[model samples]
Target: MEMSELTALLTREGLALLDETGSVESSADVARSVSRLRAAGHSPDLVSAVVGQARLRVKARPKFGEFADRMLFTRAGLEQATRLSVATMHAIRLRRAGITHVADLGCGIGGDSLAFAGAGLAVDAVDADEVTSAIAAYNLAPFPDASVRQGTAETSLPDEGAVWLDPARRTAGHSETTRTSAADWSPSLDWCFEVAQAHPAGIKLGPGLDRDLIPDDVEAQWVSADGSVVELVLWSGELARAGIRRSALVMQAGETHEITAAADADDEPVRPLGAYLHEPDGAVIRARLIGEVARMLEAGMVDEQIAYLTGDAALTSPFVQSFRVRETMPAHVKTINQALRAHGIGRLEIKKRGMDIDPAAFRKKLSLKGSAAATLILTRTTSGRVAILADRV
Candidate 1:
């Protein structure tokens, strides 16, 4: 369809036009549709509606296809943006730390920039891709002073209060290459360090970013939502405390785990599993502060090799859940099926760790029935694969 037709359709439908044909050939069709809609005078509400609908439809199909749309992999020149949760957290941290001006490097779709601006901070948001920059401008249009520029961090950032760099980790022509090591990251630690030296800066990195490469002068933080670690935040300048890395678990309702590295100093101590076992948030996991989490709970590993931490006392750790182990077993497909059958199991809550088998497939194979319900955890300990029947503590 012609651009005018697409725009008119979007305006009439009050939704963004997502040409399936165009989306299939190149996901840029969505961006083109958005541009056409804009040129034809469609409102952001209408455009967002259409795009949101298309995204939902696309995501409902297959995981890989969903990734394509989400990552903007099919788009010729669009850069996918960070998730809202991560952006909001970053903004919160920046504001809390009293950062007033920010250079948002790789500001795709301007999610982080908008959050920063909304938090009353002056922001210079930059992207190398023209289309992405334009979209970011549109996204940030409501903020009167927020500037959206098009260029790489090396050329775009100005001397400011702090620099926020989220480098493109995915290589060109590949969608699954999500490595967070300094070696794999674009704009490199060298570039980030240069920016940091110029001004106090914060770099948004993958949760799995290598801890060893983290600069000694900077503070490395892992941030999680609920009990899952989502991203790593590296801070430079006065904010970086010596030998005191921080890990945070943030919940939407404002619960947080602000753990310092010093908590783990001296020999690692092991405590027995308590009344409750709390899983650390994903951010804590990425920060590799599981040992600290265990300490916080006064807990020890269920089996040394497993991520499961147990304690005799109930403690607050936002990285993991506090589950009451109701039962235990040597896990086997046949044995598990028999146990479920014996319990008259119908509904199964399956959880796994250190296991390669697909849960859905295992559930299907069991063909469970009856009214019994149980939480099944598949994990490896110092011993080996075992199943724990657990209840939320």
Candidate 2:
């Protein structure tokens, strides 16, 4: 069927067809509909609604398949591909700073743009892809001053109070290639830096990006959500008044750990690893300030070479999590099987740190049965297969 006929069908049928037909085929149908609608000179709002409904219907099932179609049919649809929890925290931080006018460069599917607009800030949202731009326009339709434009951030935006840029880290094919140069992404740092010079700006980068790659003038922030490193936030203008670096841990319920970036300050002395080994939070690990974390916990490194930090006193630092050291097992497949059998460890929680062990094969090898749950951590500290029962702190 042609794109227009499919779009007309969607406009008449709503999204129930998507759920009935399954996302794979539904997405193709949706794409065809979008093309038809565009050809028929449909209003952007109607196009946006049809596309948004299609996306909302298919997003939960087989995400990538539907996502590709959405990106193809709707201008700003790929923005929904990656939803950064840390970005929400950054927007909150900016809102608290009393910044009113916000421009979101590369505003994917309007996640951050909608967030800022919801927070009562005027938003100028831009994206390079036509489909994404349309999706963004629809996504931000409720906001009064939210404007979605189809253009690169360098060209679309005018001077504004604050700017948010999420550089495209994943390439065209969605491969995990390291971005060594700025030109690789749509809005290059050369453009972002110029925007930063004009007004307060926030740039989002990969969590694993090298610390040295961060510009000295921008406040580079490593953010983690629920102990996982999600993204890096670089701030310019008054946001960087404290320093050029920072770290944050954002919990699911909007709780946050905000820390300044001062690497040269005197670090608290390290103590010996005690009975408990605390795993540092993702933000702290990504920020590479484990020494400071040890200071906060009054913990000493068990093995200076290892990432594990041990401490006698149980202190709270958003950096590392506290885990009770339960039992130590020998690093052999048979030995592990024997231990699991001995302890009646029917259900196993396999966690790996510095070691390389296939979780699936290990679970299958044990062939566990019964109603018992114990957390097994496979890490290469001094030894391997360190099994410990962990409870969240």
Candidate 1 residues lying further than 4 Å off, grouped into runs, are 1-79, 172-185, 226-228, 241-243, 252-255, 263-278, 314-316
Per-candidate clash tally: 22, 18
**Candidate 1 weakest lDDT stretch, 10 residues:** 70-79
Q: Return the lDDT, model 1, position 231.
A: 70
Quote the positional error of residue 310 for candidate 1 in Å.
1.8
Top TM-score model: 2
Q: What lDDT does the true structure give each of the candidates? A: 0.65, 0.63
Q: List model 1 lDDT by residue over 338-360, tens digit each.
A: 78878887888888877887888
lDDT tens readout by residue for model 2, 1-393: 123433443444434433333443365777877676668686655555555455554553332333233322332243334353544566677888889888888886776776687678889988776555665675577778899988887676665588788766545321133445556766666777777778888887777776776777777777766556667877888666474365555464457666555552233344443567777677766666777777777777655455777766767665666776556666666777776677677777777766667888777777576677676666655443354444334
